[model samples]
Target: MTLPVEAGLHRSCCLIDTASLSHNISVLKKGLAPGAEIAAVVKSNAYGHGVRIAWRAFVEGGATWLCVDSLHEAQELRDDGYTGNLFVMGHIPPAHAKTAVSLDVRCMVYDRRQIDALGEAANAASRPLRLVMKLETGTQRQGLTIEAALNLAHYIARFPYLVLEGTATHFANIEDTTDHSFAYEQLRIFNEYNDILTANGFRPTLRTIANSAAGILWPHTHCELVRAGITCYGMWPSTECYVSARLLGKDVDLRPALTWKTLIAQIKTVPAGSLIGYGCTYETTHESRIAVLPVGYYDGYDRAMSNLAYVLIRGKRAPVRGRICMNMCMVDVTDIPDAEPGDDVVLLGRQGGESLSAEQLATWAGTINYELTTQIQTNIPRIAV
Candidate 1:
C-alpha cells in the first residue's frame, strides 16, 4: 500500500535487535559442552529477519558456522562478506555443484548422482567440496537409509576431491510433543547408522542431529555441532519445546529480536450502523474512529487475522475490523484517542507496555510462530535496532 512520505517512513518495517540476538546465542552456548559448535541456521532470509543483518549479528555473537537452505543463500552470505563456515543444509541441485565448489560452500548429499556431480566439480576446480551425509532416521525426507549411507560413505572414500566432513539427520517430531519417545527412537536409529558408517571406515569429523528443539531439550544430541534455527532468532520452536526445556531444567531466556511496525494511513470517523471493510463482516454499533493500516495479507499479515487480531497504537490495543484487504486493513481505534494518520502502529511488536507477539498472531491466524515470522514479505525493509 502506498502512503504519504511521512506515513511511508513508518508504514512497514522490521527492527532487528542485535543485543537480543547475541543474548540468544549466549543462551544456546551455555547448554553446549566444550568442543561442540553452533551453526546458526540463517535460511529464508534469516527467517524473514534479513539475512545480511541477522547473519552478521550471529557471526559477531560467535556463531561457529552458518547453515542455509540453498546454494543461492550461501552465495548471498559470501557476497555480503560472511567468511565463516557456510553450509547448505537443504538440497543443492547437481547442476549447481560447480558453483558450490567454486564458492567453497559445504552441501548435504543424499543421492549418488549429487555426490558424483559434486565430486566431478570439486575435481575440476581442484578444491575439495565438503559434504554432509543426511541419514534417514524416520524423517522420510531427504536422507539415505543405513545401508545406503554406508554405501555412499564407501563410495565417497574413493573420491579424493570430495570430503565427507559430517553426518546429520532431521528430527520429525522433536518439537511437537513433550513425550520425545519418537525423537529418541530417531536418535537411536541415527546412532546405529553412524555406527555402521564408522564400522565401514567412514568416520565423519562432525556429527550433528539436533535442530532447535533437540539442541535445547536434549543436550546429548548436540554431538559436534548444533544447528540452531528458530531459537537463535529468539523464538521457541513450539510450546512443547519450551515445556521440554523447563522440564529438563534448561530454562533459556530468549528475547524476541524482531519488531514489525507500520503507520496509520488514514483516520476517519464512521457513523453507527456503518459496515466496515470487505464482505460487510463488521458493523459498527456506535460511532467509531478507525485507523487504516498500509499492510495486509500481502505483507504476510494473515487474512485470517482480519477479525480476530489486534494492533497496538498509542500504547493501546486496536482490534482489527472486518476483512483484511490485499494491501490494507482497518483497526478500530476508537479507544485510542491519540491515534491518527501517520501515528506509529505496531503490527508485531511492543508499543509502550502492550505488545503483539508472533505467537499471539500465529494463534489468531491459526498457524505457528515460525510460519508467521517466516512468511513476512522479504521486500519490506528491515532495520537494525
Candidate 2:
C-alpha cells in the first residue's frame, strides 16, 4: 500500500500537533493570576492551524472560553457542537444580527448601530444577549471613547434584551516594546473608564485587558479574562515581548506545533551562469543542482520570500533560488547532490537536528510570525497529529 504522501495525494500540507497545542495552552494558563479565565482566540482558523482541530485541544488544555473574530466563526463553532462560552470580538454586521443572536455569542461592541441591530434581533428572538464594551485605550481601533462608552452604557440600559457584561481594552504597545510605560498608561485609562462605569451603576462582571503579552508579563493586568492569541499556538508575539518576559523572569515554555511540508517534484543540473526563474532574478554561480518544490506564493509562501528563504532537505539547508512563482519554487541542492524527487522538504518545522522557525520565515517575508502562520492558505491540508 502506498502512503498518502508518497502517492502525491497532497502538494503541500501542515502538520498540526494537537498535543503541542494543548501543552502551549496549559503553559500560558499557568502564568495567569488565580481566578482569571483563559480565553483562546481561535479566530482566523486558530491562526491557520485548523479551528476544528485546535478548539478541542485548547479545551482539553484548560481554556475556559473560546473567542472568535466573527459571527460566522461563532456559528461554525456552535454547529461543530462546541457548547461553551463563545465571545465574538470582531464586527457583527447589521445583516448578521439575527445569526449572531441565534448563536448566543457574547459580542465586543463599540458602535451604536451594532447595539441597535443586536438589541432588536435579541428582542425578536426573545433571547438575552451579553455584550462587552471595548474602551478606547489609545489603540484608536475598534473602541469607544470614555464619553461614547458612557453614552453606550446608558443606551444599553434602555434595552432589556441587552446586558453589558464586561469591559475590554487592547494594549497597542505591549508587544512592540520592552518599555511598557505606554502600555501601563493604557491600562490606567482602561481602569478609569471601568471606574466611571461602575460609579454610574454599570457594574461589569468581566474586566479584560490582558492579551498574550500582558498575560505573560504582568499578572496584575490579568483581571477577569485573559485573551491568549499567538502565544496560544506556541509563537511569541514579538522579540520585545520575549525579551521583556525573560527580563521579568517569566519565560514560560512555548513549543511551536506547526510543521509545513512539501515534496520535491523534480531535480535538474544547470551549468554556471544559467538564469533561474521569473525576471531572471538569479543566475547559477556554479554548476548547480536545483530541486523544484510544489509550494509557492499561493500556498501562503510569501512572494517576497524569493531568493531569501531556505528549505530543509535531508537535514541540510537548501537556499531558495530566484523569484518564487505562483505555484512553485526552486532551491539549490548542489551541496546535497543525493537529494532526489519525492524527497520530503520541510517548509517550516524541525528536520533532523535543525529547525526552521515561523519567526525566521516571517523575517524573510518582511512580516511577523502571526501573519506568517495566519496567512497560510486554508486549502492546504492540516493534519492533526
Candidate 3:
C-alpha cells in the first residue's frame, strides 16, 4: 500500500504505550498502602502524552483520583465520561468556583478570598464545596504562608459550608539530592501543621505532600496520598530521584511510553564544500549524502539543539548538520549507503536496532526531559499503540 501525505510539515507522530502506562501504575501501587488511592496528575495534557488517553489508561490501571490544573481540565474529563474523584491542583479563580462545585470538581484553596467565595457559592446552591488547602514552606510560588495556613485551617474548621477535604504541599526541588534536606524541611512543616490541625480539632480527610520524586524516594512523606506526574509516564522526575531509588534498593523498572517517528522529506548528495541550512552554520567538509527531515523548532525539537544533536535514520545515528530551522533539519548519512527517501527516522524513540531517549536529548539541550516533552507543539498528532 502507498503512503498518503498529510498537510503541513507532518513530521513526527508520537506513539504512546498504554501498556507501559499501566505497568508504571502498578509499580506505584506497590508503594501505596491498602485503600490508599493515587491521584494521577493529568495536568498539562498528562505531561504531553494527551490527557484523554492518559486518563483512560490511568483509570483502567487502578487510579481513582485524578488531578488537573483547572476546572476546564476536570470538565474535559467529565465530558469524556470519567466519573471519579477529580481535584484541581492549581488554584481555580473565584469566578470559576461555581463551575467547579457544579461539576463536582474539588478546588485547591490557596488564599482567603477563594475560601470565602467558595463558601458563599456552596451555601447559595445548598451544597457543601470541597477544597484542599495548600501550605507554603519554602517553594514560595503558591500556597499559604505558615501563619496564613494556620489561620485558614482554623477558620475553615468553623465554616460548615466549606469542607477541607485535603491538605497538600508542593516541593520546589524534590529531585535534587542537595535539596533533599530542603524537601525534608517542607515535610517537617507539613507535619507540624498536621499536628496543629489535630490539636485544634480540625482533621482533614487527606494529607499529602509527596510528588513523583518524593513518592519514589521518601516513602515516609507519603501521608495519605501522592501526586504522581512524570513517573506515571515512565520518565524519572529527576536524576537524583533515580539515583536515590537505586541506592535505596528499590527497583523502578520504568520504560518511556512515548516514541516519536518521522520520515525523510528529501535526500541528496551534496558536492564537497557546499554550505547547508540557514545562516550557513555548517559547510560540507567532503562530498556527502544528507537527509532532510521535516522537523524543527516549531515542532518543539528546539532551535537550541541546532548543530548539537543527532537523529536515528535507517538504524544508524547521524549527526545533525548546520542549524535546525523552524520546519526542517539535515543529518549527514553518507556512511549509510542505502539511506533513501521515505525512510523512517526516529527523533525520540527506538529506531531499528538503536534508540534515543528524551533524557539524552534534554542533556544536549541543557534542559530537562519534562521541558522537552511538554514543549512538543500542539500541531503534531499523537497516537496510542
Candidate 4:
C-alpha cells in the first residue's frame, strides 16, 4: 500500500530530520543503564512527526519499545506491521480492550473497572492481556490513586488473564530543580508501591517513573524503562531540564528533528500606509517588500502568535504581520532584498547563521514545546529526511 505523498502541492510542511531524531535517541539511550530499554513515546502522531515515519525512525534508532497515547494509535502501528513491543500509555476505553488484546498492545490500567474489562476481554479472546498499571503519584491524572494503588495492584494481579507487565508513575514537577523534592517524593511513592507489589508476590516485569523531563534531569528515577517523548523528538522537555542537565555535565545536546518549510506564494511591495492581512492588525511601517506564506492557524500555527512571531526567509528574519488567515500568513521580508515567490521560507530550523526552534515559537505563542509539536495538523505534509 502506498502512503500519502505531498507531490509538490505544499501550502506548509514540516521537514523531519530522521537522522537527527535517530541521533537524539542514541544520545539519550547512552544515558540510560546498560540494560534499560528505550520506549520512544510516539503518541500524538509522534508529536505530529507522522506515526508511520516516527515508528520506523524509533526502530531504526534502536528503540526496543514504542509507546502511544491510545489503543487506536497502537492498532495503527500494528496495522503498519510493527511487531515490536507497543504500549498504550493512555487510559484505554472499555470498548477498545478487545482490540488492544488482539493487537498485542499492552494497555495502561488506571482503575479496577478497566482491569475487570480487560480481564473479560482477554479471557473472551482466550489470550492473556499484557498491561502497565499506572499510579497517580502526583500528576492527579489518569493513574490509580495513591490510596488505592496497593489494593488495585493486588487485585489486578489476581486476574489470570491480565498480565501486569509493568507499573509506572508520571512526575508532576520534574523540571523544577528547586522543587525536585516533590519529584523525589514521587519517586519514593513509586518505590513504596513497587515494594508493596513485590511483597504481595507480584513481580512486575517493567517498573518506571520518569518521563522526558525526569529521565533527563533526575536520572535516579529511571527505573526499568523510561517514557521519553520530547527528548526522543529532539526537543528539551523544558528549559529548566535542559539547563540543569547541561550544568551537571550530562549529555543535553539534541538536534530538533522537525523543521518547518513552506514556499512563498507571492511577493509584493506594499506602500507605507498599507494594511496587511485581515482585520488590519498590522500596517506597513515603511514601503516594504512582503511575502505571503501559505500557512496559518489551520496548519497549527497558533493565531495568538499573530503579532509576535518570526519566520526565516532567504536566511534572514521576517516579522509576521496582521492576523493569520485560515490558509495564509504575511511576512515582512523587506530587508531580504532578493526574496521572491517560490523561495523556501523556514518557519523553523537552521538557515545560515539563524535558527528558529519550536521552543522559541512556542514561547512566542505563550505555550509549551509539547503543545507546539503536537499541534501540527495532519494536513501539512511531513517529509522524513
Candidate 5:
C-alpha cells in the first residue's frame, strides 16, 4: 500500500517493504526455539521507518510483542489499534503511570521511587501493571544491581497491582567486535542474577538479555523472549554481528526493509573550477551537471556526508558535491545524462543494478546504521510498499 505524499513534503520519503520485514521475521524465528516469543523493538519510530507503518508490518510479520522506547510511543501504537503486547522498554515518567497502566503497556523499571505511583495507578485502573526488572550486568546504563533488583522484585510482589513479568539486561560490546568474550562475561553475570531471582522465588515470565546482535549470534541467550531490534528491520547490528553469525554457521538472511528516495528538485550546469555549496568544499573540475536533492542534514542525511556519499540517479552513481546543507545538497549527475528534475533518486536503496546500503552511508557519515535510520525525521512520510 502506497502512502500518499502530502503537499509541502520534501519529496524525500522512505519505502518500507513489508515482505522483507516478514522475511526477516521468519529468519529470526528459525533461530529460536518453538513457542519463544519475539518482541520487535519499534522505538525511535521503528528506527525512523515510521512507527505506524512499521508497527503494522511487524505485527503482520509475526511479532508477538512490540517494544518501544517510551510510554508515548506505546500509546501511539495502542491508538493505532494494535492489540498485541506493548512493552515500553524505556523509562516512563512517574506522572504518566496512570496513563501507561490504562494502556496496559508493560514497562521496564529500575527505580524504587516509581513503585508507589505505578501501584497506585494500576490500582486506580483496576488492572495489574506489568513490569520488567532491568539488571545491571555490565552496560551500567539503566539497570539495577542484583541486590537492588531483588529488593524491587520483592517490593513489586508486595503490591498486588504490580506484576514483575520479566527480567532483562543489555550487552555492551556484543556488536563492536568479533570477539564476544565480553558479551559472554556479561551473560554469565546476568545468569548469576537470574539465579538469585529464581532462588528468591521471583520467577519472571520472561528472562531476556539479548538485543539484535546477541539474539542473532548467541543462541543460548535466547531465553523466554528475544527483543529483536535492528535485525527485525533487516539491518545487522554491525559487521561483527554478520561475521559472528557466519562463524557460528547460522544461516540467517536479513533483507533491508527501508528504501530512502528523493526526486531531483532541479538540474543545473556549472563551469569548470566553479565551487559548489557552503564553504566551497568542492570545486567542479569539469563542466558538471548537478542534480539538487531536497534532502539534507535536517532530513537525517548527515552533513558529514558532504562530498563523501553517492546517490543513484538513472541507474548510475552521482557523487555528492560540496557540503550538505540543512535543506538541500547537490549531486554530480554528469555521468547520468538522462537525470533531470523530478527523476527518482535513490539515496539508501537499490536502483537498477546499483544499491546503496545503510552500512555504506553510515561509513561515509562516520556513524552507524542504527543512528542513520533513527535520526531520520519522523515527519518524513514512510510508505509501506
Candidate 6:
C-alpha cells in the first residue's frame, strides 16, 4: 500500500502537523477538571484531517478516549487493531448490534429498541456491552427525557450483560455567543437529571457534558470525560467562545494543525476589463497576472469564497479573482511577480508574515471553521508532518 505521504501525484493536500495536533490536545487537557479524561472527537474523518493519521497524534497528547459518530467508524478503528477506549457518540443502527458487540465499543443509546438489540447481542457474545445514555436537557436531538431516561436505566439493569457506564448531553448554544445563560440552563437541567439518576438505583460513573467550548470556559462541566471535537485539531469552537474564555480569565492557547495547499498549475496575464470565471463576477481593473490552482469546490474549497478569499504565494497575498469552479480557481498574482507554475500556494495556512486562517475562510464563506475544515473532500491526501 502506498503511504499517505507518498502521494506525490496529487497537486494539493492537507498538511497535518501532528506535533501541533498533539500540542493542542495537551493544551486542552490542562483546562479539564482533576481526574477528568480528554476524549478526542475523531468523527467525520477526524474533522477532515484524516482519522488514520490523527488518532496517534491525539493519543500522544494524553487523550485516551476516541469518540466517533458511528459504529462504522468504531469498527474501522477496531479492524485496524486500535484497542484504545473507543466511544460511539452517534446513533447505532439496531441491525448492526452484532457488529457493535464484536467491536467492544461503548455505544451511546437513547431509544429502547436499539438498546434491546445491543443487549441481545451482548448476551450472544457472552460479554458485557457498555452503554452511555444521551440525556435530553434541552436539545431535542438524540436524547431521552428524565423520566424516560430513568425508565431506560431500569430497563438496562434488567440485562446482566449490559452496563450503563456513562451519561452524556450536548450544549445547545454554548459556543454560539459570549452569553452562556442558555447553556447554563441546559447544564442545570443535566445536573438535576444526574442527581435524580443517582437517587435511583442507577448512577453513571462517567459523565460527559463539556465539549471543547465548555472544557475551556467552565470547570464545573468537566465531569469524568470532556469530548473535544474542534479543539483536538487546534481551533476554537467560535469567536464568542474565545471571547468568553478571555472574559472568564481562562488561559489557553490552540495552534492550527491543518494547512490546505496546492501547486500553481498555470499563470497568465489578463487585460483590463476582462471577465473572469463562471458568472463573469469579477472584471479586471488592470493588467493582472493570475495563478490557476489545481483545486476547487470539489477539494473542499468553498465556492462562496469566490472573489473573496486569498492565498499566500511566496509570502505574499494572492487575491482570488473569480468564482471557484469544480476543479480549479484563479488568484491574482500581479503583486507576487515571483510566483510561477509548480510554486506552492497556501490556501489556508501561515506563510512568512501572512496566514489565511480557517476562521477567515469560513467567514468569507459565511460558515464556521468546523465546517470549513471538515468539508474538505476525504479523497485529498492528509500528509502528517
Q: Measured by TM-score, how close is model 5 to the native structure?
A: 0.97
Cα lDDT of model 6 by residue, 86-203, tens digit: 9999989899999888998999999889888999999999999999999998888989889999999999988889999989999999999988899999999999999999999778
Candidate 1 residue runs with Cα over 4 Å from true position: 1-10
TM-scores, each model vs. reference: 0.97, 0.98, 0.94, 0.95, 0.97, 0.97
Worst 10 residues of 3 by lDDT: 1-10
Cα lDDT tens digits, model 5, 1-385, are: 1214642445688888888987888788888865577889999999878888887878777888889999888889999999888888888888988988889988889987788889988888789888999999889799999999999998888788999988999899999999889889999999999888989999777888888987788778988888999999899999888988899888788899888988888999999999999999999989999889999999999999999999988788999999999989999988888877888888999989999999999999999999999998888888888
TM-score-superior candidate, 3 or 5: 5
What stretches of model 2 exceed 4 Å from their correct place?
Answer: 1-8
Per residue, candidate 4 scores C-alpha lDDT tens digits across 181-236 of 88888888888888877887777779878788877776677778888999998888
lDDT of each: 0.89, 0.91, 0.82, 0.83, 0.88, 0.91
Least well predicted 10-residue stretch by lDDT in candidate 4: 1-10
Sort every candidate by lDDT, greatest first.
2, 6, 1, 5, 4, 3
Give the per-residue lDDT digits (tens) of candidate 1, residues 48-167.
899988998888788889999999999999999988798898989999989999789888998889988999999998998899999999989999998888888889888889999989
Most lDDT-accurate candidate? 2
CA-only RMSD, every prediction: 2.1, 1.5, 2.1, 2.7, 1.9, 2.1
Q: In model 6, what lDDT does residue 147 have?
A: 93
Q: Candidate 6: minimum summed lDDT over ten consecutive residues — where? A: 1-10
Clashing residue pairs in candidate 3 (N, C-alpha, C atoms within 3 angstroms): none
Candidate 3 lDDT over 168-223, as tens digits, reads 88998878673578888888988887777777766767887888887788778777
lDDT for model 5: 0.88
In candidate 3, which residue ranges exceed 4 Å CA deviation? Answer: 1-9, 157-159
